[model samples]
Structure formats: C-alpha cells, structure tokens
Target: MTQTRRAIVLLSGGLDSATCLAIARNMGFESYALSVAYGQRHAAELTASKRVAEALGAREHRLAMVNLGQFGGSALTDPTIAIPEDGGDGGIPVTYVPARNTVMLSIALGWAEVLGAQDIFVGVNAVDYSGYPDCRPEYIQAFEAMANLATKAGVEGARMTIHAPLIKLSKAEIIALGTRLGVDYGMTVTCYQADDQGRACGRCEACRLRRAGFQAAGLDDPTPYQIPER
Candidate 1:
C-alpha cells in the first residue's frame, strides 16, 4: 500500500481557503488544517474554520493564537479603523494586514518542518481579491524561496513547495471549482466584519466580491448576510 503524503493547509475559513483545502484533498493528500486567531476584529471566521475542517475531512485541525491586534494597523485588527464599504479607491487598501501572509506562512512552514511535510497550501488569489501586497504571485514566490532557505529540512536537501492553487483564478472560477468539489460554501465566512454568528455584513469588500463571484458563477450564494441586497 502506498503511504499517503501529508500536507499542511492554511485554512482561513473563507471561500478561497475552503476551496484550497478541497483541492488538496482531491489530490490525495492527508490534509492538516491550520488556522490562526491573529487578533482580527472578529472571530467569526475562526468559528467557521472549525466547521470547514470537519466537513473537509482534515486529518487534524490546529489553531495558533497570535495577537497581531497589538500591532493594529489594518481595519481587521484595529477596531478604530472602519471597514470600507466602497471597497476603497485602488492601491493597497487599508484592509491589508501588514506581513499577515508572511507571518501565517511562517507558522505553517514551521509546522510543515515538524510534520515532515514539504507541501503547504494557501488560498491567496491575485484576481478578484482585495488589494493586499502579500497576496501577489511575486510575494508567494519570494516566500517559497525564503522557506526553502530558512528551514532545516531545506538545509538537509528536502525541497519545500508553497502551493497557491487559486492565485491566478477569478472569484467566479473559484466558486465554480469549489462547487464541483462538494464544498458547502454556506459554512465559510468571507466578510471582513462578520458578526459573532458569522453572518456577513454584505457591504464590506469581501462580501461584495463573494456575492459577485456567486452571481458570475450562476449559483446561489449560501452566505447568510445581516443585510439583504436591495
């Protein structure tokens, strides 16, 4: 019998992340889901992450609590800054958490080394995404290179690959793909300001993009939003 390879998936409990997890499973990897409670304004997605991990059949799910809120530059981490309803006016929006992806991937990399897994999956997209500098292909590539150089396993000649499966995919494409994979989108939360119960605000940038994705995919969005579309 062939041994199943293990993979560490960075599950953010969002649409994209959930899809990434599904993709990893479809590829026959024994997935270990990792979520971070990184001092965001709400824990709604963290709650959703648990549901996603169970539904996706992850071998193990772990949460690392890090207080990124103490740094508090982005609206997600700082309560003082309001989440933009208009999606901002281009450039890197205020929603960009400084070094968030780097920090998260660093954590995932450490876990991967310990687990002896060379693959790490993250759902970072360049298309139909918030303007976060860290979500770019260049950033992902740089991180992959850094991971290979920084890890002891890499020093021992084990190659590490960071997988950003959704990097080039449009939101509509992602939704359609995840739908085919039997992912229940209702269990995921993409709202930047979701309520404690995980109900989306529907006006935030994340909600707008998600709503448009479902529309473009010609599928009904299963998200429960606090505010209905007019």
Candidate 2:
C-alpha cells in the first residue's frame, strides 16, 4: 500500500479556499484543514470552514485564534472602517489586513513542521481577487523561500512546497473546477460583510467577485445572501 503524504491546507471557508481543499484531496494527500480567526468582522466564514472540512473529509480540522482586531488596521479586522459596498477602488482597498497572510502562513508552517507535512495549500488568486499584496504569486514564492530557510524541516533537507493551486485561475475557472470536484458551494462564505448567520451582503467586493464568477461560469450561485426586501 502506498503511504499517503500529509498536507496542511489553509481553509478560509470561502469559495476559493474550499476549492483548494478539494484539489488537495484529489491529489491523494491526507489533508489537514486549518482555519484562523484573526479578528475579522465576518467570522461566519469560520463556521463555514468547519462544515467544509467535514464535508470534504479532511483528516483533521483546527482553528487558531489571533486577535488582529486589537491593532485595528483593516476593515475586516476593525469595525471602525466601513466595508466597501461600491466595490474596491483601483488601488489596494482598506480590507487588506496588515501581514495577515504572512501571519496565517507562519502559523501553518509551524503546524506543518509538527505534522511532518512538507506541503501547504493556500487559495490566493491573482485574477479576480482583491488587490492584496500577500495573494500574489511573487509573495507566495518569497514565502516559500522564507519557509525553507526558517524551519528545522528545511535544514534537514526537506523541501517545503507552498501550493497556490488557484493562483492563476480566474474566479470563473475556479468555480467550474470546484463544481467538477463535487464541492458544495452553498457551504462556503466569501462575503467580507457576511451576517452572523453566514448570509452574504451581496454588495461587498467578495460578493461581487463571487457573483460574477458564478455568472461567468453559467452556474447557479448557492451562496445565501441577506437581500433586503424591495
């Protein structure tokens, strides 16, 4: 029998992350899903993370809490800043949490070392994504280099691979691939301002991108949005 390689996947309970988890499983890795509650306003995604992990048959699911809210920088972590309802301006929006992806990946790197996992999966796409610095391929590559240098596993000659499977794919292509992988989109939440019950605002940047993706893919969006009465 072939031994299954273990992988640590950063599951955000969002469309992209969930799809990444599915892809990891499809690759024959024993996936361990990790979700971080970094003081985001729309924490409903954490709930979705658990559901996605279970639905996708992750070997283990873990949630780590870090109060990035205390610093109050990004709109997602700080309630003071308003979530951009009119979609993002051309530049990087206020929703870019400072060093968020770096922090999350560092945490994941630690766990991966402990689990003897050489691979880490993140669902950061350059296309059809908010202009977050950490989501870019350059950032992922730099981090991968840093990980190999920073860990004991790397010193022992283990090659740490950071996998961003959806990095180049457009949102529409991501949705189509997830659908083919039998992912249940209804269980994921991609809204920046989702309600307590995990319903999307349908106007935030995340919702807009997700809506467009489904439309472009010619697939019905199963996201539960909190639409006001007409």
Candidate 3:
C-alpha cells in the first residue's frame, strides 16, 4: 500500500492559496489547511477559507489568530493606510506588511512540526507579485533553510520540503489550475477592503488583480466585483 503523504497547506481563502491547496490535494497529499488571522483588512477571507478547505477535502482546517495589528506597517492592518487603487508599481507597495509571510510561515512550521508533516505549501508567487519582498523565490528558499535549522525535525535529519507550487505561476495560470481542479471561484475572497457585507470594493489592488486574472483567463468569476458606477 502506498503511504499517504501529509502536507500542511497555508490557506488564505484567496485565489492563489485556494489553487495551491487544490494542487496539493491533487498530488495525493492529505492536506491539513492552516489559516492565520493576522489582522489583515480582509478577515472575510477566513470564512471563505473554511468553505474551501471543506470543499477540497482537507483533513484538517484550523484558523489561528495573531495580533499583527499591534505592529502595523501595511494597509491591511492599519485603518489609517488606505488601500491603493492603482495596485501601485515597482519596488514594494504600501500594502507590503513587513515580515508578514515570515511570521505566518513560522507558525505553519511550528504546526508542521507538531503534525510531523514534512511538506509545507504556501501560495506566494513572484511572477505576478504584489512587489512584496517576502513573495520572492529567494525569500522562500532562505526561509526554508531557516526552517530546517529552527526545528527539531531538521536537527534529527528529517527531510523537510517547503512547496510553493504557485510561486512561479502567473495570475492567469493560477486561475486555470484552480479551474482544472474544480475550485469554486465563488468560494474565495480577494478584496482588501470588502464592504461590511463582504462584497469586494473592486478598486483595491487585490480586487484589481483578481478581476484581471479572471478576465485574462476568460473565465467568468462568480464573485461580485461590485464595480461602482463611475
């Protein structure tokens, strides 16, 4: 009998993470989804994450909260910082939360150690990046190295792999992959400043990317973009 490979997937309820989670499942890993409530502007994604996890047959779906709002530098956690409408250009955007991915991955690594899961999957991408430093491939590699050194599993010579399946995939390609895996577009959320009722602002960088990806893929996004009449 083939042994079941266990993977800890970081699910964010956004298109990328949803696609990554599906990819992990399709590769025959028993997925254990981990989501963090890091005081981002869009906490609605967590609810979406729950739906996606159950739909994708994740063995476990856990939502962990951390008070990153206390140390705010990004638009997500700070009410003072406005969500950029143009998506910004070059370097890092104002949306870049310092060490956001690192912090999240640290929690994931700790959970992975407890679960004895060597494989950890994240949805970070560089091809269609948000100009965040942590989204770069080198950062992921460096983090993986640090992870190996920081954990007992690595000290004992365990083979630990950090999987970033969507790291190189373009936004359109991510949409395509998720579509192939039957990921429901409606079950995901990508708006940075969704309305009180959880409707997308359709102007934030996240919403812009999502809309563009769906348009680029020629796939009808079921989610409401709520494009305000201009």
Candidate 4:
C-alpha cells in the first residue's frame, strides 16, 4: 500500500487551527497534530486543543511546551500584563504574543523533519484578525523560504511548504469552509482570557471576531460566553 503523506498541523484547539487540520486531512494528508503550551493566558486553550485533536482524528497528537512566558513580552505570556478589552487603537494589540507563530512553526518544522514530512499547517488569518505582524503573507513566505534553506531535506533538494490556508479568507469565509469540512467549533477556544471552563469573555478582539464570523456566516455559534453574554 502506498503511504499517505504526513503533515504537521499546529493546533491551538481554536476554531482556525482545528479547521486547518480538517483542511489538511481533506487534502489527503495523514496529519500529525501539534499543540504548544507557550504559557498562554488561558489554560483551557491546550485542553481544547487535545479535545479537538482527538475529535478531528489526527494520526497522532503531541504537545510541546516552550514557556514563552519566561520572556514576558505579551499579555498571553505575562500575567502582570492585562488583556486589553477595548479592541486596541488600531495598532498591533498586546495579544500578539512575541514571536509566537515563528516559535510554534519552528517546533513544527523540527517535528516535520523528523517525521519525513514537508508540510506544516498554521491557522493564521490576515483578514478579520487582530492585526498581528507575524500573521501576514510575507512572514509566512519568509518562514517557508527559511525552512527550505535550513533543513537537511532542503539541502537534498526537498522543498518544505508552510501552509496558511486561511491567510486570505475572512473570518466568515473561514467559518463557512470549516463548517463544510465538519469542524465542530464548540470544541475549540478562541478567547484571549478564557476561564478554566473554556468559556469566552465576549469582550476581547478574538471573541469579537469569532462572534461576528458566526453571525456573518449565518450559523448559530456554539461558543459559550460568560454569564452576561451567554
């Protein structure tokens, strides 16, 4: 039997990453899901990650801990920094964990090399997003180029591709596509400050975009927000 090509999907247990995993699987890849515990503000994020990974039928799932919190540059990594609720002043928000995507993708790249895979899937969007610099297309392209150059596989002329399938899509479009791909949004967490139970605050930028996406898609949101918003 011909072996299925394996892929490493960075699953944060949020809607986008989970959807990315579904997309990878739909593309005929035997996906190995990876979730990073990077000292996030919400503990439920990884819990939701494990749940979504299993629910999505990943060939294997692994959790890698990096503790970027040690660096303490962002709200998610530093408890001393408060999570912004005002959406921001049209600037890159504090929610932008410093070098988070870069770090996570690096970890995925290492695993992908070990697994003899050439693809890594990350759920980053430019449209309807928190305006993170790392989520831009140029950044992804640069990372892909760097991956090919730095890897032994690339030296052997094998190319490594970083897949950001949701980069150009609006949140509503992502929701629609993910729904069609059978992603259960309820199993994911997207809040910047989700409680231990994985319920949203309904005030953060992430929560705002997620809620609006469901509304724009005309789909009933399965997310459980805090008391007043619930």
**lDDT by residue for model 4 over 58-146, one digit each (tens)?**
99999999989999989988999899888689988888899899999999999999999999999999998988999999999999999
- Please give the RMSD of candidate 4 to the true structure: 1.4
lDDT of 3 by residue, 1-230 (tens): 98798899999988899998999999999999999999987888888899999999999999888988899988999999988888466768888888889989999899899988899999999987687888888998999999889889998988688999888888999999899999998878888887645678888778878888889999997776665879
Say which prediction, candidate 2 or candidate 3, comes out ahead on TM-score: 2
Worst 10 residues of 4 by lDDT: 221-230
Error of 3 at 154 (Å): 0.9
* TM-score to true structure, per model: 0.97, 0.98, 0.95, 0.97
lDDT of each: 0.94, 0.95, 0.88, 0.93
Query: How accurate locally is residue 181 in candidate 1, as Cα lDDT from 0 to 100?
Result: 99
Q: Model 4: runs farther than 4 Å from truth? A: 228-230
Lowest lDDT 10-residue stretch of candidate 1: 221-230
lDDT of 2 by residue, 97-172 (tens): 9999999999999999999999999999999999899999999999999999999999899989999999999999
Supply the global lDDT for candidate 1.
Answer: 0.94
* lDDT value, residue 220 of candidate 4: 99
- lDDT (Cα, 0-100) at 205 in candidate 2: 89
Misplaced by over 4 Å in model 2 are none
Candidate 4 lDDT? 0.93
Sorted on lDDT, best first, the list reads 2, 1, 4, 3
Give me the displacement of residue 217 in model 1, in angstroms: 0.3
The root-mean-square deviation over C-alpha atoms between each candidate and the true structure, in angstroms, is 1.5, 0.9, 1.5, 1.4
Clashes of each: 0, 0, 0, 0
Give the per-residue lDDT of model 1 (tens digit) for 65-153. Answer: 88989998999999999999995788888888898898999999999999999999999999999878889999999999999899999
Best by lDDT: 2
Stronger candidate by lDDT (1 vs 3): 1
